[model samples]
Target: MTHPENPSTFDTVLVANRGEIAVRVIRSARAHGYRTVAVYSDADAGAPHVALADDAVRLGPAPAADSYLDVDAVIAAARTGGAQAIHPGYGFLAENARFARAVADAGLVFIGPTPDAIDLMGDKAAAKRRMADAGVPLLPGYQGTDQSDETLLAEADRIGLPLMVKAAAGGGGKGMRLVTDATDLRDALAAARREATSAFGDDTLILERALLHPRHVEIQVLADTHGNVVALGERDCSVQRRHQKVVEEAPSPAIDAVTRAAMQQAAVTAAADIGYVGAGTVEFLLDVERRDGDHQAFAFLEMNTRLQVEHPVTELVTGIDLVEWQLRVARGEALAFGQDDITLDGHAIEVRLYAEDPSNGYLPQTGTVEAWQPPTGAGIRVDAGIAAGQQVTAHYDPMLAKVIAHGRDRDEARRRLADALDRLVCLGVTTNRTFLARVLRHPVFAEGGATTSFLTDHDVTGVDLDPRDVAAVAGWRQLAATADAERRSPGLAGWTNATWLVDSRPLRVGADDRVVSLQATVDGIVVTVDDQRVLVTGTPDALRVEGRPVHLTVHRPGGDRLLVHLPHVDLDVSDPTGLPPGADDAAGAGVLVAPMHGAVTAVAATVGQQVEAGSQVVVMEAMKMEHVIRADVAGTLVEVVDVGDQVGVGAVVARIDPADTDG
Candidate 1:
C-alpha cells in the first residue's frame, strides 16, 4: 500500500505549538511512522504535549512574544532536536508567510501551504481582491491602502451605518468590533488598531458593511502538490458570542442540496485559483434577509490558510483523517480519493468547554484543575489539553477541552451532546458546562434555528437546581468526612454515656452567601437550608433524598474543598471553619482587586483623584484580550497600581477611601 515512487519526506516532525492542537498533531505524525518532537515555553514545561512527544525542547518564557511566536527559537529547537519537518499547528505562526519561508530556507519541510499561497491569502485586503477577480460574490467594503484617519472616517460615512472594523491580519475574533453609532466611530477605530497591533503586530484594518441576521458557514478544502483539490463539505458555525464561535455542527440545517453544491464549487474554485496546498477553510456570510433569485445570497468572508478549530466536526461526518492527509500531501502525494468518494454518514456537534463564569459576564477564571472527568459513551469524543493538578493560568486561552458527539440524526446528536455535558465534571474553578447544556436543549436550538445572534437572542444563564438536593449533597459529604476521620482515630468520635454525640457543620455552596447546617444522625443525616429540613439517607455512593434515589460521586481534592456530583448538578462546596472569630466577610470592600491574573495595561486614576462610583480606573490585558476594571464605590483613590504591573486574582490594584472621609 506504500507509494514507492513518492517516498516519505521526513522521519521526524517538530510540533511548533502547545496544548491540544500540539497533542493532536503529534498523534497523527507518530501514526504515520514519524518520530515527533515537542516545543514548550517555561509555563508549559509539564504539559501533556511535551510528555507525549518522543523528544522535547524549551523555547523561552511564558509570554508568546518571547516563546511560541519567536521564530528564531522555534527554528533552533527544530534543528537541535533533529526534526526533518515542522508543523505549525493552528495558532501562533500557522498563517505567517515569513515563518513558512523560514522553515523552507532552513532546509526543512513546512507541513502546510506554500509560502506564496500563505502570503496571498493571509492578508484580508489582498484575499478579497483575488476572490472577487475569481468570480466569487463579495460583500461591499473598503480594503484600500489609505491609512489616514480622515480617509477611514470618510469611508465609514460612505459605507453607511452599522459597519464592522476588523483587523486585516487578525483571526480568532481578536481585533474586531461592531459599530452602530456614528459618534462612537473614532474611539472604536483607535481601540481596534491598538488591539490589532498588540495581537498580530499589524495595525492595518478593513471595514465592511455589517450583515444583519446572517448565518456563518464555511467549506473545508484539501489540496495536494499533484494539482488536485476537493471540497469536504460545509459546517454551520453560526452560534457565536462576542464574534467567537462556541458551537459548531456539520451539514448545516440552513442550506439545501442546490446551495450546498454551489458553495462547495465556489470553495474549490477559490482554492484552485490560489494554487493552494494543505487543509484550509473558506468562510462566508449567508444573508438570510437578502436573496439572489430563489437562493440565498452569500458573500466571501475570509479564507483561513491553516487548519481550523472546528475541523473535527468535518472529520467525524466524512470519516476522514485530515491530519494524515496533511502529512501525505506535504510529501508530494496526491489525494487518495476524489470529491465523489466523500459521503456524509451522520450528524456531529461540538461545544468548546472554557474556564469561565457564565453568570459573571463570562470572565475568564484561573486555578488548578483539582479534578477532571470527561463523559464517556458510544458517541462522545473529548479532545482535552488539561489534567488533574495542572495549573490554568492567564497566559493562554481559556479553552480547556472540546466535547463532541455524533449520531444518526440531528436530534439524536443533540440529545447525546446534552447528556454528555450533564455528566461531565470539572472542579477547582468555575466553567460554562451547565450553560452549554442549557443552550443545546433550548427550544430554539432544538428546532435547528440558532443563528449568529443565538447568544444575544436567548438567555441561557440560568439552570434550575433544587435547594433540597444541594443541601442533601452537602450533608452527605460532611457525614462521609466524619466517618473517615473517626476510622483514623476512634477517640475523636466523642462518646457521652456510651453513645456517640451527633456533630453539626456549616457549608457554603456556589455564589450564594447563605450558609446551611448539616447534622449527623443515627439513621443518616439531616440538612437545614433556608429554614427547610431535608433528610438524606443511605451511603455516599447511593443516596435516598426524600425517598428519591440519586447516585453521587464525591471528591475532596484538598483542604476545605468538596466536589459533589449529583444526577443533574455538580456542586463545588467549601467549609470555612476554624477561622478567627468576628472575621470580616467583606474585607477590602472599597478596594479594587484584579478579577483575574493579567498585566495592567492602563491606569486612569491617580492616588489623590476623587472619582464617582463605577468609574473606570484600570485596564488589564490577559490571554490577548483586554478587561476594564471600575471602582465599586465613590471615593478618593488612596493607592493606585502602575501600568505594566502583573497582578494576580484578589490582589489589590487600587484602594478607595469613602468620599465622606476627611483628609
Candidate 2:
C-alpha cells in the first residue's frame, strides 16, 4: 500500500538516536530541506545533535533504558515536535519491530523497513530460516530452539570442533563466542547465553561452523514500494576487535567480479524475500582457505534491517544518499535511480573514532572533551557528535565520531585517511587515535589481507608502546627535564624554577611498570637506566640532546614529563603509579573490586561458592556492553555486589577467599 505523495513532502523528521548518528541524520535531513527534531537523554542534553536540530526534546536520563530505547518517549517527542516521520539513526531502537509499529500506529511514518521486515530480520534464528529457505548459503551448524547445555554440547560434538555460539537475536557481534574444544562447550554456552540475555533480551543461542580466516563481507541493499530492490555493491568489514567492527571499506579486496555479483544477488534475494523496504545489509563470512585449496564460501550471517554505520562509505562511492532514498521510499516515491544508472565510482573507507583505550583491553574512556577538531579536506568527511568541553560520559557508546575518506583508489583513500588523521586532534581523553593509525599502517592492511582476526594474529597487544618508541620517549623526557631545570634557575638558560640541582625523579611510561630515573644538571641532563647513565641536554622549549635539537610537543605541569611528538611516534611520560596505598591488601583481601565504573546488572557470585579461574563472578554494564568479571584465580567466593548497584572504578564488587592450591 504505497501512499501517493508529492516528491519532497516531508517537512519535518525526528532523529531517533543519539551521538554521532543522530547528528549525522540531522545534517542529512537539513540538507534535504527537512526540519530535524533531535531527541536526547539527560546525559546528551548538551550534545552536538541537540544544538544542530530545528527542535530538541528531552527523553529521559543517561541510561538508554530510560531514554533512547523508550519507545513511548521517542514517539511522544516526534509528536510534540510536529514531525511527520521518524528516522531511526541505527542502534538503540532502530531495528525494534514494536517501536516501528508504535510509530506507524501513532500516524507518523517510520523511515525504515516495515515492521514485518524488521521482525523477520531482527531475530538471527528466524532470519537464518528465511535465508535458508531463499537458497542462500549457510554455515553448517545447529540453529534450533533447544536451550539445554547438554543438548548443545552434543550437537557441537556432532557438528565437529571450531564453531561460533551466537545470540539468536543479537547484532553488532554481542553475545558471540568461539568454542574450539568440547571441554569448554558448557562454559561457552553459559557465557554466550548470559551475554545474549543482557544484550538482546533473548538468551536463545545458535551455533555456526567457524571459518579460520573469515572476512566479514556485506552487501548494501535498498528497496522501494514499487518492488524495486537494488544491491548497492559490497563492503569489507573485516577489521574487528572483540567481535565488533572498527573499520569498514567499500568494495572488498578479496572478492572477484563473480563473487561480488553472487554476494550482491544473495543480498537482493534476502531483502526481496522479506519484502523489505528502505535500506538493509546482508552480512556474510567469506572463507578464504587457499592453504587447504578450499574455494571461497560466503555464508549468510544476518540482516541488519536498518542503515549501517558504514553507509557513508557506500554513499561516497555510489554518489547516492541512502538517507534521501529512505525518505523517498517512505514517502511512497519510486527510487530516483535504477541499478543500471548507479555507478560504484571511487573507493571509500570509514574509521570509527572511539573514546577508548586499546591497550587497556579497549576500556571506554570518559572525560570532558577539552578540544575536538575533525580533519577537513578533499574527500574527507567527519560525522562528529561532541564539541569541545562536552562531557563524554560512560553512559553511552564510546564512539564519539566517524571519520571517512574517499579517493579514486584504495591507495589514495588510505593516503587521504592518513592525511585526515594528521589534522584530527582531541585532548583530555585517551582515544583509539594511535591504534587506528597503527591499523592503517599495518603491512597486511596495505596489501589488503586484513581479516576479522587481524588483531588476533598481529602484535597490537602492546599498542602505543614499542622498543623504538621507548628510546624516543626517553630522549624526549630527558630534553624536558633539562628545559625544566634551566627554567627553575634563572641564571642557567636565563630562567628560574626557584630550586637548584633538579633531583632525580621516577617516570613511568604507558602500561609498562618499568621506571626511568632522570636528574637535571646545570650543564645537561642525565637518565639512569639499570644504574647506567645516559647524558642529555635541552632547552625548556627546544632541547639539543647530544647536539641534536629535540622538540617536545607538550610539557605537563606538576612533574618532569613532556609529550613528545616525533617523526615516527608520540610518547607520554608520567608516573605509572600514583598515590601510596591506604591499606595493605591483606587487610581487605577477598574483597571484590569493581572492574570499572559501571552499574551492576547481575551478581552471579555468592558466599561459600567455589569458583575456578575465569569463572563468571559478576556482570557490570558499562558503555552499553556487559562486562563479566571473572575470578583471576581459583578461590572460594566470600562476598559480592548486589544487583542494581552503581559502583565506581576500584569499588569492590565481589571477593574470593583464598584456598589452598597444593593437591
List per-prediction Cα lDDT, in the order shown: 0.84, 0.79
Residue range 1-663, candidate 1, lDDT tens digits: 111233365788999988888988899889989999999999889988999999999999988889999999999999999897898989899999999988887888888888888888878888999999999889889998997889999999999878999889878887788899999888778778877887888989999999867899999999998889999999999988778889999988888777788888889999999999999999999887777665678889999998888888899999998889988887778898998998998999999998887777778899888788999998898888888788888888888888999999988989999999988878777788888998898999998899988888898976666778777777677667667878987778433565534445566666554467666567667777777878887766667787688766778876776787764666777765643575334535578888888989888889889877888898887777777888888888899899889999778899898766344
lDDT of 2: 0.79
Instruction: Output the lDDT of residue 470, model 1.
Output: 75
**Candidate 2 stretches greater than 4 Å from native:** 1-8, 290-296, 464-502, 508-592, 602-604, 612-614, 659-663
Report the error of model 2 at residue 364, Å: 2.6
Query: What local lDDT score does residue 214 receive in model 2, on the 0 to 100 scale?
Result: 91
In candidate 1, list every pair of residues with a backbone clash. Answer: none
Taking all chains together, each candidate's TM-score versus the true structure is: 0.93, 0.87
Candidate 2 at 510: error in angstroms?
Answer: 4.3
Candidate 1 Cα deviation (angstroms), residue 552: 3.4
| Clashing residue pairs found in predicted model 2 | 487-496, 488-496, 488-497, 489-495, 490-495, 538-543, 592-653, 592-654, 592-655
